[model samples]
Target: MTALAPSPTLSETTRTTPGAGWLLRLHRPALYLWIGAVAVLAVVLLWLGGPLTDSAATAWREYDKSCDTGGSCRYDQDSIVRYKDVYAYTTAALTALPFVVAAWAGAALFGRELEHGTAQLAWTQNLSPTRWLTTKLIVPAVLVTAGTGLLVALHRVMWTAGDGRIDTADAWYANLTLHANGPTTVAFALTGLAGGALAGVLLRRTLPALTLALACVAALRFLADQLMPHLWPAVTQVTSLADGYRGSGLNVDSGLVTATGAHIADPGCGSTIVAGCKTVYADLDATGFYTTYHPESHYWPLQLTTTALVLAVAAALAVTAFVLLKRSTAAPARVRTEAAA
Candidate 1:
């Protein structure tokens, strides 16, 4: 009888098997798409920051000068509208990146493999489930982080270029502009990736996983938006009722301040500018208008705090996914071991 060949050890088998290389090859299309998107967005952002902003600024200057002279105003009106349109589109696209990441990670990255038994097959090939999951998350997380970081930087550059020049430029605290111009968007994207992976592992069905992942991302964003202003202490500006609510930025609260040092909600009217509102304020014993808001100086603080919160959530999701995978795969291994014995 022929001598039996020895079985390969786990370490030897793992060493021979492809890890991220195999993954890259399998998801080549997605990798290409992501790269293409980044390149296109980068080019557009550059254009926006340079030529587009210049043209818009020039047009605004011309319009302002004409108005100052009290002459018939004439300027490149189209340039102003074009700048606004492009700015809106780019900001929207950057804001939507996280949801795209969530959909792909849920449906194609994890759900498809687990749903079709491919993930199990990979595990049997000398790869532990944990290693498999780790590779999946790590590779995508790196790519997502890098791409989003670059895009956010570019977006910030573009936004800054137009900040003081374009009359209609979005304020630093505008929701879409705020997220796109800072690290918070990058954090949101990573959170989306982790949340999606968790959804996929938990559901093991493509459609359901995709749905749940999107829902999770949406909820996270909503909560972040609601919590952003409170992340930093807002500056309180109190102005006489005649001056009205004068502070601007991310408004946390605004109300009427009474002589008794009590704060009461302002009526639907904005300020004492309106005669009716003045009467209302007088009746309420309002001594002044108090506005609490996060000014431009607080932008980074808000962004950083929100980023930290989102990253923490992402970490928790990733850990949960790993633990769930381990428990799910452990039962089958135990059954196999008992049968063999």
Candidate 2:
């Protein structure tokens, strides 16, 4: 009887499989760093929502009361300034997170492995290239989504806490505040991960992949900003030229309405109350100012639409990465088959 080869043991099989456990081991430092960063930011957001917001609100109330009685301002100016400073810092940090994620995903997560032949070595084991790439994308995507989602939730809480209380608080539609305070940030971070993975698979070099990934993410962000305003129907409020532009929230367009009922660009002039603005309006035959904008009621609609668009792009990028990986690995397998034949 021919001697039968022994089947692989459970431990051997587990070691060869490129699962989350091994991926975690390979990237333990990055994992720890991610957890630490998320923890620190979470703490800051909580403090901003609780203590800082309370102090700032109290100061504002005191200032308002003093102003009503025409007394000397006795509010805590230091508290207000500190609140603004912390808010600015936190907003900046949240805005920068996606780019940081892209850089790390490109350079360390995928690029370095491909550049150093580590990915190929794994392929020689029981792990297929597809499985390897899938594992890489899925695990990191989950961690990134969870961390970013938590940060976004905390940021919203912080922003909402100060609403109508702090006089100088950022508007809900402020560019950075809008993105940071919604699901859009989470979607953007996921897109960055997918874009970085695609860059790595295409370039197969660390620095170049990192640069390309950053560029891709930046472009996506720019496009998302431009696209956000038009995602929902904006309400138009037309007022007499003397009233000037009058709508609040996310402004889509503000222009002059002609006597013929046509919208024309504003000549950078104020209301008719201004000396030259009246003459400019008369020359243009402008009758009123038309302002088109999304009110606060549309905030959720805009956020959800933008997030869906970004998530779609991310899915496409991930699929393209997988396809590229398959084609790349297939060529070598084909070559080996030819050699054996």
Q: What Cα-based lDDT does every candidate model obtain?
A: 0.89, 0.91
Cα lDDT of model 1 by residue, 1-341, tens digit: 66545444434545575477666766777998999999999999999999999999999999999977997898999999999999999999999999999999999999988998878877887678999899889999999999999999999999999999999999999899999999989988988899888998999999999998898889999999999999888999999987777977999998889989898888777666776877887788889988899989999999999999999999999999999999999999999999999
Score candidate 1 by lDDT: 0.89
Candidate 1: segments with Cα more than 4 A from true spot: 1-17
- Listed per candidate, the RMSD to the true structure in angstroms reads 6.3, 6.4
Error of 1 at 166 (Å): 0.5
Compute each candidate's TM-score over C-alphas. Answer: 0.94, 0.94
What tens-digit string does per-residue lDDT give for candidate 2 at 137-183? 99999999999999999999999999999999999999999999999
Clashes of each: 0, 0
Quick one: how many clashes does candidate 1 have?
0
